[model samples]
Target: MKLVLKDYIESLKEEGELDSLLTDLLWSVGIKIFTRPNKGTRQYGVDIAAYGKNFQNSIEDQNKEVFLITVKKGNFDRNNWDSGKNSIRQSLNDIIDVYIPNRLGKQYNNCKINIVVASNGELSEGVIDNWVSYTKEQGTKNDKLNFVFWGIRDLVQLTEDNLLSELLFPEDHRLLLRKTLSFLDLPDYDLRHFYELNEKLFQKCLPLKNNRKLIKNLRLLRLISNILLKGCVEMNNIKPAIIASERVLILYWDWFKKRNSFNEKEPIKELISYHFFKIQINRIYFAKVQTSYYSEDGLSFGIGNLLEYSLITYEQIGISATIGMSELYEAMVHFPSDPNYSETCYKNAMQVSQSLGELIFNNPASCYPKYDEHCIEINLAMILFYQTERFDIAIQWLEKLISYLRDNYLLKEFIPLFITDYEKLIQIEVGGYKEEISSSILITCLADWCIMLKEDNLYKNLIELIEQSLPNIDLQHWHPEENTEENLFNSNAMRETGSTRSSIKLPKNPIEYEMEMVEERNIFFDETKFLHNNKGFQHIEYLANRHFRTYVFPNSWRQLLNTRFCFNKP
Candidate 1:
């Protein structure tokens, strides 16, 4: 395991990969970093800056010291030792002649500075004498100025001690991670194992005795996830990696929200790093999905079976919808600081929405979902449609869907149900058994959109149709039971009552109905209502959909209700 991790560390790039890992290691072992890696700016050769004990490794306790670290990826050689502007030698020179004299602030200047040249690979034997002479000469100039070098072995040990310790990822979990990496070609089995690992880690972190340990584990999770994704990239299949990263993302969000650690630097920085990895995977997979958008199945990936066609097409469209929402979320969150940040995001979001619309229009399979579990993707697409205010297409689709399900009692073609058990869902599909449709996340969302859009007639017809055709279907709205948020987030159905829902409420006042649902669950869809740095309501539905492994649902409502894709002001 250590050797595998060491190899991945050596494979990392300097800008966003290696530097970020090193920063996490610094924080993990008690180093206080003030300036992190920021590209597209002049940093005087200092890739990272921090203050702490005289030595970086926690194992070697020493006197206090501050640090200016210049990081490089892979092996270091003679050219790196004395090459031109990009060389470590020149970087060290800049750190001393430029950063120390001008850039180092007064507050951190009092302590003797330790200028460390760090890399994830070994230093060439040819550069040994130069390193020795340089450190000796630097020490002679000023007692406070010390020079140091950290190679691959040093970084591996730092990672092993602080992040990859057995105390965090147990033997079974480690095996599961290895299996996940090996199964990149098979996205379903791959995501299953990955999610299992996440669930176990979440359970372990929840009862932690201290935040320090928790942060270390979270940081480790992100690094391991990135390495798995790197493997996916090498193999030319990152679909599983994208879904797995998204799974861990919401898992971390749930943990952060429950632990109230969003304000802490360590976890938030960890999230940002994980988010960066997610963007990388999405960019790669999005290109592949986009290229096939005008194809026969829109996302067939060459799967020839009809059932397989419908499954993959709807799933792909759902993923595209998620990508769109993510783009918009990024824009809204950063809008406060950078007023111009949203233009590109808005464009990207609409482009993705257009892809979804076109995928549905061109691919007949998209309208025919495989099982009730298909609602997860279908609902996500519906959210994107209403969010972009592409109501005509969405309304037409919803009417067709409601009419199809309302009349068909004999066939199990994507019938809505409350249960999320995958095995039972599959059995229903193959065994010729029909679903009771007692609980429905799909109907709930369709009804909410009808009311929100003031399609009063459609809303009334949906309500009456369910009552008459599928009389057993409750169409109940779900609400989080009192103090059951933890059980909800953890997917612990062992609780006495994790949730409750209402019978369909046909409100005469639509505005009052919207506010009542939003405030009832305290689910605010308006991003502007929350602080820029904090999480908003989208996460609630994300967590629910993920944990339930069925529908993109709100915990309140017959299981889906108030959530609108377009950031409804209510």
Candidate 2:
């Protein structure tokens, strides 16, 4: 598949194909471009002019010499062979005679000029030999002039080395996917091939720029994961799915290590955030696969291997947030089978939870508070304790969560209003509530836990706190300006949604309205501000359903309903 794609790209005759590819190839190898092929001109026979610094220092420090590149695309078949050679000679002549003289008198007199002639196909043996001899002779005549050649094979090798081949030849990727599927039936299976394939797949999906770039890369990542997961599922075997997911974790860990090698001046939060989401997808895949299909033995082996690898990743990469997630995964995996070990796992998780909160969420230097990590950690603690029937520990985590929410002013503003609107919509369908329920989800969860423990005093105090806070939560700040972009989106969502609820409108089928809301509400302090409101509702909904499912199903609560579907079903 790789060879076929390389050949196809080599055969391309479209204008700018060779130039753009050469640009990418040079850029990947740390050549800093001064100018490249301009829109409508041949760029003085120099396809790309760049500083070809020594390879090691090229990326790390400044370059002192210039390299002028000339790229051509053609075979040496009789008709055009002379033209191709002549084109190269002219490009070299331009660099040595005109281009260097023009630049040297101004800014680069002492610097050397290196001529690179890159072509899509090889010259005949005699032609290359003669060309090299003449090029070296010319170099001797001009003390600072040196030259080199990059044939199709060299370019392909460069592309592969830097993991940029997929972007250069996207069609090759599509073809490779087909080829991968075909190899599934082979007697000798190579998991390393699958691993390498996923490494490229993930590299293509990484932001490679900033946090905003991740907004789109995330969707691409999901699309890729879905395709891979779907393919594994179609095999009617869990092993392939597990193998793919294992490879994902390994690659993701390597990405984390690589990010560390980057200069500390770079903003690392976005890269860490990217890793957060990547781990999130892996966690979800494992949860789904475990519940849906895998045998107990398979599940144990895969998750155990994953958890062990995660520990090593934590030690090597030293990202506490990732380790926090690994512990949470460990807890979840231990829950159904090893009840005793589950508690131990959750305890380990809670410690990292605290450390992560202190190091990231509480650090003022952090642009976005690691609220997603906070939520995951807090929820894991809540679920772990609640499952173990430790009401006191569950309440502690719940209180801690409410305090976390209170620290973030935006969440404090949005959660109550969102919950109030949600509850009012609920009452309009059913009857009004017997009591005035407070609009905070954590408060509600605490109330449930308090009642379960028969702590009537604590439950009553919590209710009082919620009732007082709900009225104080100013909804005015929550509403965007009437004519602003935010309000325009809200208006559009309201008009387009066929929702029965009179409070807040559900998004249009596209749900861009929700994205707009997320954008408006996304404080840098918490990148998950968009998700927190939705996830808060989800947690409450899950707890409500769980409450009903348990021995504590009360007559008063019997009519309270669950609207969301569960993904944890067997």
Candidate 3:
């Protein structure tokens, strides 16, 4: 009763008598519409052209003045037909001026214009009224115009006259007729053929129901049928493109389930999840590219590489791992602590991570063109070293990263030297550097290093600088708006404060610090000298206090100053 598109199409392909039965039904209807005698030949420009009946009316005559009937086959609202009237009228004009005039001579301009519309269900009163109005208008304006409409009730009445029964043959043959009729795009026929065929098939194959191969084949057939039907309906409506794509995926899943039998449910579930996950990842990648965080040209290489690794390495390794057999153990580290884990899942996750890393860091030219290669190279080296827990190497890499940031003038256009390591720093470029700090990476890196070194003061200084910089740095500010926040905070304080504060917490392992106060906003540091003058400190404190006083409570500035400078700390 509520058949999906696939089901309707599959019903047409049924074997046994059902298939033949349906073909006969359609053929009979075709004959009735095309071969009737003494009917006025007029090209109504209907979707279907049928002509027959008299010997004098050959196929050529049918081609010229055949009944141009539009068949609306499914559960469409009658209003749709009413709305389509204007389009139908245009189609009629095209038939008369473009198609019929040349062949029948201009003298046949008075030829009959018969418009017939057939539907599978009854037309609503509103649709009928609209149709009546259109017909009356056409007839009064042009005496040659005529129309005829048929509903499902009319077809049923004809069937009761034994017309359809006479067309049926053997019992099995009747099933084919039913199937054909069910699949036909006949406006005046119900799905009785499909229902009858399905009933017959189920009865005959009751014993073979449990056959695995049969079941599998049946499922595939069903999936294909659904796809075809859904495609047809979508083509008719032109709105369900996305829905149609989703149905295709569903059909694919069904086919996949039938082809594999490994515990059936688990693999199917995992496959579907993986499919959707890949779609999500692609969406995120596209969104990033659209936002300019990634260049368009880089996307082809990045996405292509990712897909290749995923389909080849990940899938192959995963399959092997699932079976408890994998040679990739030498390449992958597995914790023996977890006994129930599958190596394939872990390997797949690692491969995905690797692919994502490639996309993020591979095309530095497009991603970070203004920065010196040495700067990004060192930063990446530091990231790798940090991940491996080689703290000393990471620190060395960070130093190089810092030196590159300070030296590169174009990089300075987007990022101040001090905040280069913060994660929010990237957002600066992304947000168009209008309101918020152009970068947060410097803060993030500072925090990471301080936390690693167990230096509380360095971490505190980083946090304080971030807080102080928050108000002056508007994330919404962009070019031409005067980079006022650009030179507001002393970068020298930002770079040195992390080490200076860390020294207070680790006096024995004190890190040397030197401050280069180029301006209010730009600062640099020399890590060899663990010294920061009180002059630079006073300037930073002044700006912090001023900002706090104006934006926050005046009393809060004193409290913040005391907290930041250790004036009140025990």
Candidate 4:
């Protein structure tokens, strides 16, 4: 709840970022910004211009109103206050003398021009009076001209009043999380208070169509859900948590479904969909956890309705759509007892996955070829086909993935980069800076599928891929696990430690060395330099390892390595 307004302004990185946040805030409060600050060109002192009718009736007798907002950030002490105030006065002079005359002369002649000075530092009473006096001196006879100052206190107050506390001070999530903990601990849990509080909170957010707020709310809910899920499962009582999660999810679903007013072209829609899908994925995963714990065969098919709306609302947004459908399929695919409804969910997921696969193929770069989302469509399509015993069609899709990877990034040019700069390889695997095929994973996957089908045709492709992959990998210096088929097929073994044969031990105290290599191969190869930015490297490692794990290679394929096979690339 402590608003460090100066620190917040400093965190904005650039004037443009702050302007964007201000724009969203203004738009959320029913103020339509007609012009934005052009950083690439001259802005002429006016950072933004907005117009709206009767904003909370702030101005008396106002049919039309306009707000000219200027933003400045600094410590306005005695040393800098005068210069800062003069600079602002100059901008205001330009706005009143030149901008208003040229831009809004006839249209806003009857409109009240509310000149707002939003500053990160304090504005002393004398400075504020001087600012007001300057405006008054310029518009002595013009009653419609008004000046307002938003210093540190005013901006903090604005954030609180507009329910942007969560977006501004993320520490507010801890408060919400505390509330959830207390609610769960209540001996006689009353749904009434839970529902009431949620309704009130949502009502506060309802008017603000800003996606940032939506994303913040979604993140908060996910965090709470995660905490509740852990608490529920650990206590061996999941009913309360399940109820809470379902209630929150229903609220989110309703709110999300009603958001038809947002412009589709805005990048915020992509962000909104990203958080929205994460929320859905978390909610359904929790539901699955509940189902698994209770052994319940009779949960409602209401999620199908949610997915239907999701598919319609965000079908074009492929990553989330594909991920959502995949999670939905996993959640519903187990209920064989309810053949009709479960089958419906499964079929819907299949259809959506097929469509999403085509979407990715059409624009692979958007999906980021290194991202696991890149392979979700392929994994889903193959799994669905394999489940239905459609071996031939599944083989075709599997072959498509194999060909795609081989043609795209398994070339000599790219393979050597991974060998030389293993860190860049991690980056490539995670879709960091480039869109390249994960040769190791795709080869392993194809080997697994060929073993499953006992098809020599695809098996030959796997051999060729292995030949291509092994050349750059320095077999003499590189450690390979025991030639057991089991090790080869275990994607975790291949991904985490590179081979099941390697082992690493951490020091008793981490600070014994400047840095430590967690992976055995990286340590053996003196690859600590690659981990200069540990967090970024770890993120890449996680995504890369996860991408490798998405599709498992069967143990049956390992025996093929023993044969002296010479086959042309398919």
Candidate 5:
């Protein structure tokens, strides 16, 4: 496990990756971080500045001292040590000559300052003589100044001591963590094991009362997430990590929601930190896999991988859109002063929604939904377009998709059903599922979305077509159950879903009507619910779908729902 962590650390870059991790490490270790790494800032030589009790035993001055650290990436050789203005020695000199006199202030003047050089890899042996000479020369300037070098071993040891401590990471937890990193890029893309491992990890944190201990656990969780993301980045496939991160965030939110930990400001801030990290992962996916699926080499994967490749890309677009549109206001609420961020979210939403439309138009396979869960994706994309004021694209895409579903359903059982079996769904495209085609969760949702988008013609056509094509199967649209609030978050909660056939309506202004409709079904989506108008708590069908995916029922829509209201963009 130490080796695994060492390698993970070795993969970090100096500017943002290693820089952020170093600050997180410092916070977890009880250090007061006064200054941190900032991009576009002048080079004053101090990447990090903190004041804390001395942890180093070799230093006899045990009183509180300030730490001035300079961090870089990879192994430090002679070039890195004293190459030019950017060299380690030059940075250390700037910290002393410029920063201390100009910026360190009178408060820190009497305190012993430890100037440290750090990196993920060890300093080369040839630089030792130069380093010792430099430290000796710097020491003569001030008796209170001290110099230290932190190499790979020192970093590994410190991380283990602070973040992945023995008590926090017992042998079993260590094994589970190792297994998680190993299984990140597995062919199945099933993260049940990953979910279970995090459940166990979170469960372990609940009983401990010490605040510092909790910080260790949270920091460790972050380390594990980073390691998994790094592996996905290497493979150029980040969807699994994105899905896994959503699940982990859901698990964490569930814990907070259950305990009513709303008062704990720090954890919420940390939640935002993790949320931003998840968004970064999505950005990476967009940058690397842009149009790769719909390009000439789109369907070039081996037979086994092609189906999943096509299917998940569609799912990715839906997840991204839903997040952007829904969470736009919520994020702005957190940072209310930044009005420009709202525009950024709008731009991202438009880009992803447009990409989804392009994929549907260019790639025939993308137009096909391989599983009923794709309904959630479709709904999310539509809502994004609607909320972001891109209704034309939303309406057109929904109409085209419903028409495609009708045409495909008539020709063959091409519309994916509510089946969780991976092989069963893949078999639908490869050859055909000979079994009696049963109910579909997607078609009904599409009909509802069509109504929401004001496409009365398309909505009526879908209703009539489902009756003619698959007469025996009833189409489902999940609604709130009685006593829904209590059971909604329960493990074995039974959800109520009625046939769309029961309720049929047409409205000229579907957005206003849909708002009323959603309020009637689940009050959480109701903008007027917070007025104490006797409509506060209800089982939001979508929220429950994301929260209650268990082993027995792998709730295929979990990924889409988990990310729906959570924007994954900066």
Candidate 6:
């Protein structure tokens, strides 16, 4: 049977009758766009490429870059090709070494090798072994090569479902189906025949009540449905077909509920019901209803209906307030904030928030006993309200929430809010604050406020505090010792008792000005030359400026430090 089909295919090809043959085969497989003679040099290294319009083409067509196609016209021998692998191995090697490198450039590393062996005969067990072994050898550890094998069996299977019969040729479809049927396992053949003979019976068995067997059978039916859907799309009536199928699924669900002992009032049923209804709403929104001049009636209807139904069902069941709060928050964040369409969404969100807050505060046994999540939500709402110019309410809410956090030892939770409020307070200049605060919260707030207010004194004080907190060691050396205050400021002491006083005289002018003068003066003299030649007084002015600029109160304390130290280079 395979030999006869192969001869017929070959005869068609020889007589230049392959256009119809190719069309029939492609149509049967649901391929839409067939590029004939795929006109390119070997740079493309692909033959007969077809693009599926339904597939997204955002990325470049990698199938054009690399593709493995097997064209077989003979009977496929899975066992023989597995046993005698050498002949098939050599054939694959010849293609890779000679055809790829010669036709495509030697630098064409991305080329995919395809094998097309059409014979007017059947392949033996040895031939199958050889093919499998060849493929295995060519496959690298990194999977740089891929191989796909096709035979008469595949062509026959393609024709079994009237795929080719609906197309331009019916006899060829019958022949291919008969050839493919010769290789099928008896059980699969039986199932296929049963479905072919009694389609309605198969559909009835698909939704039976046996829990263990029902899932398996449903999966099989789903596979068949997918194939049929693909066929419909190829034929270009997919939308209507899909709608009809969805309606049937809905009717089936209703029928199953009526017939089965399953309780439709169960929680799982409610969950499934919610999901199914939501899916239907989404489909209607995106599909059936057209846009209106003033509003998107489809979206409004879909979301509004879903929301109303969900709330009614949930309220009846006494659902968790947390679930309501979460859903409300999601709606608010996702949907538009427009006053027209979103007014209901916003009102519902607020209601959910309030109810959730009350539940958390009043019911100790509720999941959220401390109500930390609710507190965060309230803070976010307050922040949003503040942005919207509802300052009085925002401030009230913030104060209450901050006080709650402080009372509960959740000061960490309010740190960010504290910083923001502190900045606002400083901008308004309501209070006079003195002395350093220990909290990181207060320090950050004060630093940011000082920067914003342009209060140089406060800024300098903050910088000094930061410097003092830093580890007092020179990091340039491999072995560094702690830099004591005595080493840093001993010369500036009012008395010589060496107690390392905290108070040091501030520079007469701003430190930046002194540093600039020192930098300008030092540009004229070379420190290496001075050290090498021992020229003591040549750059005295620059040296004096460097000392004055680098140290605090340079004029008053310069003599004390230099009194016992002298640089006499040899």
Worst 10-residue lDDT window, candidate 3? 512-521
Give the runs in model 3 whose Cα sits over 4 Å from its true position. Answer: 1-44, 54-65, 73-113, 141-144, 154-570
Clashes of 5: 0
RMSD of each: 5.8, 22.6, 27.1, 22.4, 6.1, 30.1
Backbone clashes for every candidate come to 8, 1, 49, 0, 0, 17
Off by over 4 Å in 4: 4-10, 53-62, 76-86, 125-129, 165-570
Residue range 277-302, candidate 2, lDDT tens digits = 44444344434432322222222233
lDDT of 4 at 531: 31
Residues 325-377 of candidate 3 have per-residue lDDT tens digits of 11122123234654334354344334433333333333332122232111222
TM-scores of the candidates in the order shown:
0.76, 0.34, 0.24, 0.39, 0.83, 0.21
In candidate 6, how many Å is residue 258 off? Answer: 55
lDDT of 5 by residue, 342-391 (tens): 66755665676666566555556656776776765666566556656677
What local lDDT score does residue 247 receive in model 2, on the 0 to 100 scale? Answer: 44
Q: List the residue pairs that clash in candidate 5.
A: none
What's the C-alpha lDDT at position 23 in model 6? 34
Write candidate 6's Cα lDDT for 347-465 as tens digits.
54454444333333332222111211122233233223322334444343333333343432332222222222434433323343222222232222223223222344544654454
lDDT of each: 0.70, 0.44, 0.34, 0.47, 0.65, 0.33
True-structure lDDT of candidate 2: 0.44
lDDT of 5 at 350: 63
Q: What is the C-alpha local distance difference test score of candidate 1?
A: 0.70
Give the number of colliding residue pairs in candidate 2: 1
Please write out the lDDT profile of model 1 over residues 306-335, one tens digit for every residue: 656766776677678778777777677668
Regions more than 4 Å wrong, model 6: 1-65, 68-91, 101-121, 159-570
At residue 320, what lDDT does model 4 achieve?
26
